[model samples]
Target: MTESSLFKRTAAELAEAVAAGEVSAVEVTGAHLDRIAAVDDAETGVHAFLHVNREQALAAAGEVDAKRAAGEQLGPLAGVPLALKDVITTADMPTTAGSKILEGWQPPYDATITRRMREAGIIILGKTNMDEFAMGSSTENSAFGPTRNPWDLDRIPGGSGGGSSAALASFQAPLAIGTDTGGSIRQPAAVTGTVGVKPTYGGVSRYGLIACASSLDQAGPCARTVLDAALLHSVIGGYDPLDATSIQQPVPDVVAAARRGADGDLSGMRIGVVKELGGEGYQAGVERRFGEAVEVLGKLGAEVVEVSCPHFDYALPAYYLILPSEVSSNLARFDAMRYGLRVGDDGSRSAEEVMNATRGAGFGAEAKRRIILGTYALSSGYYDAYYGQAQKVRTLVTRDFEAAFEQVDVLVSPTTPTTAFPIGEKVDDPLAMYKNDLCTIPSNLAGNASASFPCGLAEEDGMPVGLHVMAPVLADDRLYRIGAALEQALVSEWGGPLLDKVPELETA
Candidate 1:
């Protein structure tokens, strides 16, 4: 098959072809490397990847080809190439987390998730761009520069995990991995018109993910289709001894759920419409599309009901307080005495001086801002008034989910209040940027299985609109079932995936 044709195939299709000897893994890997070269350039590129592990990727793909040639059995996504989010450690690749602090630092060991990918024979194409320390909503906070939306070059791809989502939307990779500490995965998916899942907090191992908020962060899959995500999810999800929070249980049958949903039946399924998630403050086009999706679900045999989660209004404030407190504590380990970037350490400088200088120069503006806010919140004198209160609010948010789920199988909302905004539009506005995660944060705070699926395009800008679905923790299969059913219904209406309608960028 031609390289172009190979790039267009889904991860499952590529794996099936390789297993059947219809194509070599090397050819598929090479096609993606070529595509990355075309669009991931430094000057006029999408800036999706911070580093590309070209040599290692080809070597891994070749190994898969050899195994297939030897008649050895392989996993479902064995030969599919994936772009990993920078936050995950890889012993062979530079994992900077999009910050100058750890720039060019390669970990000596692979993260559990990275090891799992290799064992499954999935090729790691490279580490994609992200917000520095996963702090900001827009990727413009990256020390390496931002990842542009493939659909609209001037606009932002969703933040923190933008690089991963953009790589899929641009057809640079069949699959990608992302971490959602808040809306890092889902928001980017919403804007990029791709699929992203934030599995239950402990559903996937957090052993190798760079910590943003220990309780809130979870690594999950990003892909072009629900089935592809389900396939990747099965490969990555499971218990890990290294992660204290890891759940010791079998992953839900997500692949089976995706397949079942493709038949488009939601009979007896109850979907809750979050009352606070839509209406005023949401974009006119976004609300219009969400309203239509609710109607469509009704037509598909799903009983749709509006449910109120009042404490959700406090999710934003509570998240900011809790996340920064954790950030301040977690980032304290990056002292100049250890690895990563060190500045002004010419021997003449004292250890304190060098440490202060290094951090001053290493962290970006947003990182510094959060660090300070977190430090202050965590300080002894003021801890109770701020950090302590936020934790209580966190409990309320989780309780809200428990009550809502008691009444419905899953909850639905607009993934993002608006479509992709301009790259620099909200960079200077921290409040505005934080507001972007409004619909997505409650799920993170509650530690549930949540996903964003492309619903339709906004009428105003013709950009993609995503329907956010949240299921009870450990009930991840519900999200896929609903997403697959909704996706099939929408695809039939739109004639194809939304990414197919995205305009190609002009080559420099």
Candidate 2:
């Protein structure tokens, strides 16, 4: 392949080519670096990355090339370059979590996934932008700036992990790591014409991953194709002793499942259409595209039925309460006395004063809003009325999932209520922005495996719409199976990946 075209290859293909000696690891890594320079930093750039580890990436690529030359066995994703969300700690790079408070803070050690990727020979392109403390639905809350959708520069890429998704959409990187706390990973993929998975809670380790909501946050793969995502997923997923919540099970054979799904057969699979997740608030085009995808699944021989999870109606409110409650506790560690940003520390003020001043200046509005809301919810008199009640509601949601899964192998819905909305269209309206995750939060609340796959473009605006799939915990492979089946069907219809329809970015 020509150097310029290397950026267009999927991670799996690139890895195979490198392993077969068709292209050196350095060449593949360089092609991606060159692509980032040309599109990410251009005048009309996607602004997806917060930092680009060019030198480190090439050095890692060189190491992979040396290993290949020595006839050593390499991991399946060896030599593939990946964009990482800023929330994952890297010893060599700053992990700001898109917040000014932690700006320039270099982690003392790498995140578990970061170390795993390095051991597997995956080159780290750099840290991508995100919502401040992973708090908002739109990337607009990022302290640096919002990442633009590659499909439509004026529109928003789905929240918190938008930078990672945008990078994939623009071909800046073939694979990425994104954390999903209330659809941060899947929702971004939904908007960017990409694939994103939220592995079952505890499916992937949380060690060194900066917390959004400890119970809700999960790190997962992002890619342009479901098979590519499954390949990447196998690399960074598994048990980790360092994370107290890590599952003690082995990672599922998602790659094999994806390959099986690529044959486009879902015979004997029972799929459920989430009755509560669509309709009233959904966009006409989004619902239309989602319905079409469901029909395609039926054609693939999957038994389709409408299933209702009634408690889902309360998920949005319950999630907000629960997430903020955890955010309040997790963010407390960032006091001025600690390692992050400090303020009012000239020896004349008390530690409390310094912490107050530091947080006042350092935290963005959304973070502060959540902190306050959470504090209030957990306060003396209101705990039962808010936080405790939300927990009960959460239990109900999980039970709903249990009941639904009893009758179906997996459930499906429109990933979001609508396609990508224009940037700034809902930033000022927090409720509007929060609603973007409406269709995705139930899976997180229930700690089930979920994913977003590019179904097709919405007819009204020609923007990509995602089909959300949810499976029981530890059944993450099921997500890949369904995503791959739909991806194959959709790619066949579109004559290529949906991202092929994206307008080319201006070269630097």
Candidate 3:
């Protein structure tokens, strides 16, 4: 382990070193803060973080060191620093969700996951940026400006969760928390050469997550390696009474599965390749890398076969309708009458007028577009024609997943159709932007566990390509098992992690 560049180490390694008294938590935290200050320049930096809680982070790290000094038993991830997606609320930090509506708003209470992280002694570094209300495929929708892909500064980092991915890729943080609603987590991971998971919908509580689409939204761990992600997943996932939708069951033993696979064996695992997610529209390089990944799985002793999920073709259209409908409702709480930004509130103005003004000023174009589309879809007679039909389609997609799961333990596909596109390339093209989620949305509709891990870099643009693996609702361990196995194989083949090939950025 190289102590000089602590930022390059994995979360698990950092935790181990800290727990062994090889290094103090405050030292680790301060080193990361210093790195952030050096590289996260306003003009050339990745701009992954929206806020950096230097004071609080250092204090938390010091507390961990004190606890260890007192001979207290610390958790597995104790002293490992993490970046929180702005979509998750925090009592100590501001959560904007990349929207002006909630800018500078700090909640009085911590989210369930936030509390869990604290209990595990994981220092919350600060909030990373995201799409406005978690609505867009790219972080371009963020009012805070976009996060640049570390692979290529001119390109996108992937969205709603791009900041988290970007932060990991740039070595600003070893771990991050991301919310996946129509691929916010996985898509970013796919493009940035990192690992991201979208656990079963209720696997992690949504109590403090700002709603995007209630039924589709899920929070999961993002890290550089499968085992690190699994470690973070165990720390954050479990039942929460505050979240009515939270699963009242034991969290999967992802850490054990990851360790098993790290030994590089997947002999009895049955992996399915989804028929509908590939071909025509997918970039050739993405397909090539995905094909190589499948071959690696076969050599690792896993059975790989193609399975059709016909209804997956309709996932995007259905998701667009259902998500906007939910967004219209969930985002309604941002009216000027409550917390956050308020506009046109002079005595002469009516509350309704003030609300209209506030919303008009606070929302970005993409958000307004979705709100209008959602409002129209849920309108009197059209509800049955659009929103109602979309729900039926959602059921069909779920059924497709259920049917496919019976034939295989896990399913595989390219996490995204292509690698990261240049920033501003699709900002004005809504359809092109929406297409990015085609490979990732079905799992959200089905409420299953899905993850993206670096397969290899696409030859065309030299950007990362992710191999997506999905498993049934409580079978999250399956994702880590395969991911860890594949990662080990790829690492052995390449002589290092995929991010090792990334071009070095000139940090300040």
Clashing pairs in 1: none
Clashes of each: 0, 0, 0
Quote the positional error of residue 171 for candidate 1 in Å.
0.3
Q: Rate the local accuracy (lDDT) of all candidates.
A: 0.93, 0.93, 0.93
Instruction: Report model 3's TM-score to 2 decimal places.
Output: 0.99
- Report RMSD for candidate 2: 0.9
Error of 3 at 151 (Å): 0.6
Model 2 alpha-carbon miss at residue 262, Å = 0.7
lDDT of 1 by residue, 1-508 (tens): 8887999789999999999999999999999999999887766778899999999999999999999989999999998999999999999999999999999998988999999999999999999999999987779999999899998888999988999999999889999999999999999999999999999989999988999999899999999999999999999999999999999999999999999999999999999999999877899999999899888888889999999999999999999999999998999888978799999989799999999999999999999999999999989989999999999999999999999999999999999999999989999899999999999999999999999999888999988888999999999999999989988998899888778898886554
Question: What's the TM-score of every candidate structure?
Answer: 0.99, 0.99, 0.99
lDDT tens per residue, model 3, 186-290: 999999999999999899999999998899999999999999999999999999999999999999999999999898899998999999999999999999999
C-alpha lDDT (0 to 100) for residue 60 of candidate 2: 96
Q: Judged by lDDT against the true structure, how good is candidate 2?
A: 0.93
